[model samples]
Target: MSEQTFEATRAFIATASAEQVELIAAALRSRRLALRPAPADTTATSTSSLMKIARLGDSVQIARIQPQYLSGLTGTVINTRVTRVDIELDAKSTRKLARAKQTRFEVPAGATSFVIHGVHLNSLDIL
Candidate 1:
């Protein structure tokens, strides 16, 4: 992500409402519970080809990119798409989001969602 987009995302999370955060947390938990380990297949060509899939509610640590103020932050995966993952950050990460910028704007009171793209998949380590 670019510096500008990262800043915007951080701002959004920082100003999110408590209810929103709770909802995201719940979703993550639900997803985590639903995950099932893939069955082993003798027909499979390569074991290494079997990717480590990240389901919802999985605990994850994201690597920080320099020039972005926040260092690596841990969070729960709330949602997933073809190319992006939505995460509900933990309290410490949320605080970092709040402090990412000097100026603040009024954000509607609700849930805060953050996205990390597939290109940065290497930065995401599932716990």
Candidate 2:
């Protein structure tokens, strides 16, 4: 007896005319779905990456005119001998803020005064 073997059948779209092939190629080139996956080793261009870098120490401006009602509302210098400054924010004052919490900083003591301008405590750091 002879041994029998099975084979699976495969099918493909019939080849198109030269003009049709060119048209299909052009259509594929125009659509994102037809684009090949990017090469694995390819890195984003250095120039483009440089554009995304942010300079941490940049000049920012803040206005310091105090409102009439809160004339006495000012930052107090605590533990002058210590390098770090801790500003205690009252819970009642920050309860409305989504990230309502106290903020601390390690700023030079030479600064004449700290400014609290924004709704949050960290906003004072910019000053």
* TM of each candidate vs. truth: 0.43, 0.17
Cα deviation at 21, candidate 2, in Å, is 0.1
Error of 1 at 17 (Å): 30
Q: What ranges in model 1 sit over 4 Å off?
A: 1-52, 64-67, 102-119
lDDT of 2 by residue, 33-79 (tens): 32545567968533211111111232222123233222223343222
TM-score of 1: 0.43
Best by lDDT: 1
